[model samples]
Target: MMSFKRSRVIGAVSVAVVGVALSLLGSACKSDRAVFSAPEETFIAAEVDAGECAAQCSLDGRSVIRSCDGEVIETCAAHLACGGGACQAPCAAAAADRSSNGCEFFFQIPRYDPAKFDQSCAATFVVNTSLEPVEIALAYEGRKLDLSGALFRTNPGDATLIPHTGPIAPGESAILFLSDRDPEVAPPSPYDLYRGRIACPSGVVPALVGELPGGTRIASAMHLTTNVPVGLSMIYPFGGARSFLPSATLLLPVATWAKQNMIINGWEANATGPASQIYASEDDTEITILPKVDIQGSIGVKAARKNMPVTYRLDRGQLLQLVQREELSGSIVESTKPITTFGGHGCAFVPSSDLGPCDTLHQQIPSFDQWGSEYVGVGYRPRFGNEHEPMAYRIVAARDGTQLDYDPEIPPGAPTTLSRGEVAHFVRGTGDPIVIRTQDAEHPIYVGAYMSSCTEGFNKVSFEGAGDPEFVNVIPSGQYLNSYSFYSDPTYKDSSLVIVRAKTRGEFKDVWLECAGQNLTDFRPIGTRGEYEFTRVDLAKSGQAGQKFGDRVCRNGLQRLKSDGPFTATVWGWDYAASYAYPGGMALRKLVNTPLDPIR
Candidate 1:
């Protein structure tokens, strides 16, 4: 856990007003740092602590009063100008507000301590649309390299001069092979968000390689950006102390970051147990962790347990790891500013004691603001059967006073007065994996599915002795996408399948896949979760090539999907070749009507 020196904001003494309780979240080093509190209700002018402040004045509209143990500081108005940077004035004091997304950004993923694993990293990037060829460059250890040749095919030919004609077209994908290494310094690791102006020359969206350097170990949580809407995922494979490997897709931009989130440990029944990791990225992030014991124990008729409000201020690139030997152990994490969260079991068992599919699993939890009451969770039914494979689903509430009416009634029914940072846990219960929005929409709820480990290959039923549970973001129908260009990992022997389901009755008017050249003829029903239908496309049957699914020259790039209306699609990869189960993942939704650029 690396730490940056905080740039404390000191100010001139001035008239002060009553203060509110200050919230504090922190760094790894607690000893040398001093803690202080804000002035109580009636605060007056006080001297500024020049070198003692730990926070810089916020430029974004995310400023919150930060405090140490217990000390009084300047007023909110004054703190805004303390960081020493020349930023616009606070919006409250202005006649009109003006804050918008920046054109350039470099996300910082927390670095993993090298001492931990046999270290290896693998990644791929997919630009969301077919746009003018954007010039892309790469920066590693301070050395800049031109990556446009391998990643982008422009009108001005490259060294090969083969007259570029790749998935450089709309709805297509490409691979980034990064073997370029420089001597100045290794890419910034752990906690530090590295964004070099020189790294991305043309200033195409902040992003990442070929032959990718051999010593590559993306141990830390990763941060990638694209000039256009793009998606990328990195995996820290199984290794020492980390037999349960974890891989996570980067969440969408801060424009969509939410303040309230319900932790959904997307795992299954009869597992070794709950090992949850809570991670948040972005500045001005303040999270309050409501442990499970506190929630369940606070049930009506039962005396409330003594659970203190423990909040953490998360810096970009930091992950708050909370692991415990408890059942579905979860927490309600609330943030002040827009922040992204990821929760998962460190290492879990599918059938509890079964060793084969027991691997690490995690997914970036979507903000409740984006969650929908209606969700259709498609469970995996291997071509061959694994009778006992089970799944668990949790409904997380984003706000208090949420009213929930289920299609398949949940026993005690959802709590009448669920508050922020609370959750209701339940299994598929003979009913389908769908949560129907009923009784209320004032506060949204997130429906998450957890699948147990399964057979590595079709009917290879001997239970490979160990399998890993997998978690996925069961996107809401409201967020269904009409078009997407995604790829399958060639590292495995089997190809993954894409599940596209209709969001509403007649929602999926028509469907098309690149493989067939026309509307899908095999569209089928997926349990009628809603008054709609769904269909699946098996890329394996399309054909296989040395580097992709199609033949040489006609190589299969990212699979393109276009439907009449909006629909949600998820991809599941089987770890058959790895002799283990790979927790499947969902594609970054590029839905219909989504803005090409986020509003400021």
Candidate 2:
């Protein structure tokens, strides 16, 4: 019998006291490099003989004295406020206000076995969107053994509990690297949030390759918690600096987890296979997988025929990985408890028959509860100097008899109606954005965007002019927000953004990109779609591709977008047959029957 070691850490902090007790979430590390330190103290405020009020300096050095009746007795400045009978710093006072979505997130870095060689490093970038300074930390978990050997092992006594413990200033961003490479091989300088190199962990073992047997115990999932709301983007760069093979996904926080989800993936690949991975948020999570295509079996996991359901169980911080020879798009996953899922190919050819070079594809998927009936379908910008080049897209139905209507006219090969779990594929040329909607909210669907293949032929290699395959989810009109805080990677040679905004009274509203130092007024209306408009911009600091990795230029660091009406955006970049794209951000508002979890 195989035995696995597990740890049960308390989910939340609790304290019993006559007066309020404030305790920081982390303690000082005794290592030679001290990240943060503070004496864990219990303040017995009730025993203090001070008068009816208390006095103290705020964390930001603001002075304040407040009465016990929750009355603000004194405030040092317009931005300062009295808290716990003392002036509070702007960050401490704004700590109560979280991001629009959530603060706690958990995810695993899926294996990205490149077609040529194996690249083992992945990065998770975080942006602080709140006024409060964010403290990022990982949930405590005991080391464990899997069917392979020890997974993500650290040095003795180094438990790997903290993730660059430090304050992330408001509107600033940080990127942490997770890799199996040597620890001394660190990312270039100027990354504010990087603590050190972390060991890479995952549900799929590299040695086992395509087999994920039952009861595999590996502590490879990352458990991130923040004092305030933040946004996360995960990147797995497959090719080295000389070549481009990177895949990324904008991570959704745990508060957005749902009991039901649908899979959207790229075409099958011979290298790493097409797959979907799910992470369990609570113990004893029972999952049902209904494959749209026949699924291959592992050692202890049975194979399931198309439409046949297979069941599996996972606990918190544990994950289930499913890899199949056939493309797994349109599959349905249901669970007894909420779970987070990601779907993509290890390395795939966007137009499977078009090109020679292929790249990895990955995107975190939203659940059925968050699906919407209306979407803005925009194609990628012209690639490789071909102004007439086309991009591919797919719309997956969530309910039976879902009818879809397109503005102006539908694309080349799109279907007007679809059955539950069925997918409709289409291709649109550059400058041909369209609006897609169903009859009503009763018929919701998921939409995905894809970049065309490199050069479209094996014999003709236009490495410098063309970009390989890349995948990004399209945000629904219902999930659009007026403001977004995003990041654009400067590592690529070219970075471009597509902004889709709703129009009012046949007129497009004003939009602004704060970091670009420009106000956008060149919005072009989507084909005969009177209610919406879109435009694409190259994200250059001074409208030039001079930004490099670790550069604090407006094009590389944290970015801000604002508009009068609801809108959504996508940030993408390409470098010689390599590309990456992801949604700027979206509101995870509930649109179905799944009960929403409270943000902790």
Model 2 compared with the native: what TM-score?
Answer: 0.71
lDDT of 1 by residue, 1-600 (tens): 212233322121111111111211111111221121222322111233544433322212123233222232333443222222222232211101101111112322212222222223233344333122222344443346444443522110011112232334323345443322122355444432221101211222222332121111211233433443333333334111122343434334444455655566544333333434344445556666555554222111122222444565565644454433443333555666656555555455543545554545555565555556556655544323432344555666655566765544553434444555466655453123344563444456666655445543222244342223555666665555444444444332323344545632324456545444445655555443445465554433222421121321112224444443455555544443121222122322211222111111
lDDT of 2 at 403: 92
Which residue pairs show collisions in model 2? 384-465
Tens-place lDDT digits, model 2, residues 405-438: 9887976688899988787778776577878889
Candidate 1: segments with Cα more than 4 A from true spot = 1-117, 128-130, 135-170, 176-221, 238-250, 266-285, 293-306, 316-319, 324-330, 381-389, 398-438, 455-467, 503-507, 526-530, 541-557, 577-600
Worst 10 residues of 1 by lDDT: 94-103
Provide the TM-score for each candidate, comma-separated: 0.57, 0.71
